[model samples]
Target: MPRSTHRAAPTPPGGLSRRTPDAAVPLRPLGRLHDVASALTALLASDLKEHGLTAPAFHILAVLRRAGPDHRLTTGRLAAIDMVTCSGMTVRADKLEKSGLVVRERDENDRRVVHLRLTERGLRLTDRVLAGLHAREARLTAGFDADELRALAGLADRLERALQHSAGAFRPVPPPH
Candidate 1:
């Protein structure tokens, strides 16, 4: 038997360099992340729409739940965590309050500062939403075995660290309409 050999086709003159194919050049990893994020966002948004809430409103409820029984978070801190402007947060808080999902109270120690907290109804709603979210997450992970799931989680953590490092210097802008 004779050995076989393979050679890449030669590049066309004045075309893209052989080192980087115009069509096959490596793409930014962030592109894939963005796609995954957009899909997930759409799924969540659809779910929230049925409950008469937007994603941001759902997030506010979730944050309040995580803050424990007190369910209190400063407006400034919540805005920072939610990646929205102070005015935007105020508007969101106002809507949630009117919807009976949250309440605003003056901080005892800082009279000028307002603290946002979830109402009992808000807590119940959060619990229900979280249960649904957990079920969905489990379904997504159902195909993976324990070891594979662990490996996937580890890879995700590493990728998250890389993204966080790079994100400090990159401010995401809204995609063009």
Candidate 2:
């Protein structure tokens, strides 16, 4: 080759691709956390799929079930609690309504506001799914002793708090034109 225009990207100490020069410093631990989270998500997703639910749908159902006897919440409030956009909530509500698991009702006082209420069928399904999920979770964590579990929970809590506190410090990079 007379002259090569291609240059291979440099690999960091652990042979991992570096997004930024400083990324290597935090990559390993964070990578492990991501891996564990992905595995847990897969496990949970499979369980949900068996019950004819996806993760988002399950989350909505769980939130409503937790809201007490009436099993009702304003769409805006549900969207906020679920950390999803109102439009996204609307889409989910549409699917749920079609499934006969939920219903939307205009607010009596304010016609502009809408509420989502779980149906009796939804309530029963949620209860059954939750029971199965809890048992699965217990089995998954059975290997961990109480002290280890506590320590892990404490560390995860700290990480969550730190991430929340520093949320504004990070920004998404724009794609190249």
C-alpha lDDT of all candidate models, in order:
0.78, 0.81
Point to the candidate with the largest TM-score: 2
Candidate 2 lDDT by residue in tens digits, 74-109: 888888876789999999999999989899999999
TM-score of each: 0.75, 0.76
Which runs of model 1 end up more than 4 angstroms from their true locations?
1-33, 167-177
How many clashes (backbone N, Cα, C below 3 Å) per candidate?
Answer: 0, 0
What lDDT tens digits, residue by residue, belong to model 1 across residues 1-177?
Answer: 543343334533433223333343232466556666777888888878888889889988888788766988988878887889999999999999999999999988989899898889988888898898889889988999999999988988787667667948644332211
Candidate 1 lDDT trough over 10 residues, lowest sum = 16-25
Residue pairs that clash (backbone atoms under 3 angstroms), model 1: none
The residue-level lDDT of candidate 1 at 90 comes to 98
